[model samples]
Target: MAAGGRASGRPAKKKGPNKGTGGQKRRSLEGKGATPPAHMRHWFKDKSRSERIAREDRGGTTGAGGRAPARRRSEDAPEYIGGRNPVLEALSAGVPATALYVAQRIDNDDRVRDAIKVATERGVALLEVTRDKLDRLTEGAVHQGVALQIPAYEYAHPDELIDLAHDAGEPPLIVALDGVTDPRNLGAIARSATAFGAHGLLIPSRRSAGVTGGAWKTSAGTLANLRVARAANLTAALREYREAGLFVVGLDGEGTTEIADVQLFTEPLVIVVGSEGRGLSRLVREHCDVVARIPMQAAAESLNAGVAAGVTLYEVARHRRR
Candidate 1:
């Protein structure tokens, strides 16, 4: 009767239809195998990458058109030589070098080797470095493998220079450069100073060339053998020299007296030469006790700085010798 439900206290089992969907199962399987969209791939490709990583991993472009910068080598760099004949000449002449650098490879060249040998003999430090090392030291200067560090030149007090002359047991014979900016001119003047037995060289600190390697080379290493003094104000220095019983003579084209006519040997004197382009500064000309001109052939308007100094020095020396 009612399927004998619970009449005998027994559990009854009922059966119903299953509600499973094949389409739902197929949809879930499709979601599991889904692929990334093309736009997503494009976005990932557009992301920024590390430069170093690109260079190492992907071979990216370098800054200089995909090329590395050129490297500089050392042998072309400048080196300094001190205490050698040239260095000593520059110092004694007051040429104003601060430090000297010598290359180790200098021993390979005869001239440089000899220069090093002498520098070592005089207790100067000779640094040895590769050509690349020297290039780094000079920072791309055309140092010719030799260079000298020079201080901002300072002038000895005019009084001190005069005193030095007196102490040397000789009359003060000083050569003053008015506006010579060429180191070669300075070197030549230094040579003349040494050869003529002058006391020292006087140069204006500003607008004047300090002793340099070019000057030293031009002096044929004679700058090391002379004394040089720099002046803050050349006119004032000249005035001081005058007060010290030294005649300040300016060499110019328009001079009242001839250099030959002046009696340079008997009195203490300071000879001044102007620049090659500009003869002399106005102030320097005014400070001179005498302005004398060197006699030259009409063919040449002026003499080279070195030649003119030599001539003047020779005349002074001749007069002294007489």
Candidate 2:
């Protein structure tokens, strides 16, 4: 046997599987750590749920360890109640709010303080976001350093409007908007409806204004007391009301009957106000039991949708009172 050579009894020792080389080859078989695709590297891929949730709570992380904000809650997506008075009044009126977002280092006026107090009392989540976030949420409107996250308004069914009147032991008196698109107009109509004893409001689900925060503020807190319903088809809804024994009265400048003289106003009535520019739609006019005009001083003049509805409601209320 040569010096420093493996000893063997009978045969020269074979190169015993090249121990060092074999180990190196085995290691080489395992490739280097490669980065995963961006989508595949989501935190949810982690087997441990707690770790995944922690990462998610921390706004999640990209493959490169970059952070991304979590998805917005459905309740906080749109429908912001901006302005100090709007936020405070919405809070005071018990409007369903998902969260109250106050700008960091706000002016801390009475309205802000009251809003915070009310939110705290109601257990509403209070989020402190940047002023820029508030501005974006309010869409460049004057937010007044505070904004409330309002969920979609829960609208009542058309039948519920009548039920409201029945509950009050009064004839069903509803104010239906044919195509009014202004939130402020809707708000003012709501105010007038509530004040003049109209039971509820009926707004078309599409191509019409809804009860937004602006409308809520314009209603002067009357929206809290009033039930506003959404109708998928305004003309069809009028027909349904007619079938239910309630008279449908549409407001237009060219109608044959004057609002004050329309006998239907005294009955279970649904006064339909048209759009600000076009007045009543042709199909809606066809559905009315009586298409009545708001008596005006000049033939050329036209009243605003809100004003016409208010004036017509006043006439109905007057007749009901007498």
Candidate 3:
């Protein structure tokens, strides 16, 4: 037996199975009881939600051809209006909200109470969530214990626009956007078209702006009355409109004829507005029955789609009334 060695007393303390540090690995493997719900978890924050919203505000990061890439929310994402007053006013104005989120144990003030009442009358879903969840839903807006979700806008068809005019015993006057990708411009054009007695608006399915919250806000609520239709192939749609007795008039800065002098003013007309930077595409320009320009006094370079469409629509309305 050596000095520090285990003496040969009892078989050198027979080595048994390795127990893995008091079996603490099993405790680490176990989930600390049933997991808590996401809403209840403290660490579950709405990651990058604010960044996503900022991107959407910045026109959603344009992809190839200047079209917004995915732009998820405006198409399918539910928009939320936080704050008691905003929620109540939106509900009162018939904003077509899908759901109303109420903070649990919230102070039932008049605005919140009325919002809930109107939501109930309109059959909107009422969900009572914690304040933290409401904050997350509103992206940390001053929700004041409430939020209203507005669904993505629904667009009509091009043919439906024609039918809308026909059903009203009037000729179709549609505004077709050639390449305009700004929602604010779309909203302004929509406002002008509706005001000028146009039936609806036509936009390409791609490389065009869609009806969004920005559009809705810019239109000053005119979008509610005006219908917007989307076409897969803009040139092909223009051809179809031409075949159906509608005159396709392209608005461009380089046109020889002025919009007021176009002879197709009396016909069922589709005013095609191109993008601001590049006016109209070659194919769209060739497909138009008339390429017209807005008369300008000075040597201005160009007008945006909204301004050009406004001027052109006014001229059409004036000529038609004459």
Off by over 4 Å in 2: 1-78, 298-301
User: lDDT tens string, model 1, 83-121?
Assistant: 345544443444444445665555345545564555455
Error of 2 at 240 (Å): 1.1
lDDT of 1 at 103: 55
Instruction: Report how far off residue 5 is in candidate 1 (Å).
Output: 42
Measured by lDDT, the strongest candidate is 2
TM-score of decoy 1: 0.64
Global Cα RMSD, each model: 15.8, 7.9, 9.1
Compose the digit string of candidate 3's lDDT tens values, residues 112-192.
889889999999999999998987676666789988887877879789999998999987899999889898899789779
Model 2 TM-score? Answer: 0.74
Q: What lDDT tens digits, residue by residue, belong to model 2 across residues 21-116?
A: 555466756767897765686664565677767876555645545547554435224577788998888888887788999999988988899999
- lDDT order, best first, reads 2, 3, 1
TM-score of each: 0.64, 0.74, 0.67
Steric clash count of candidate 1: 20
Residue pairs in clash, model 2? none
Error of 2 at 162 (Å): 1.4
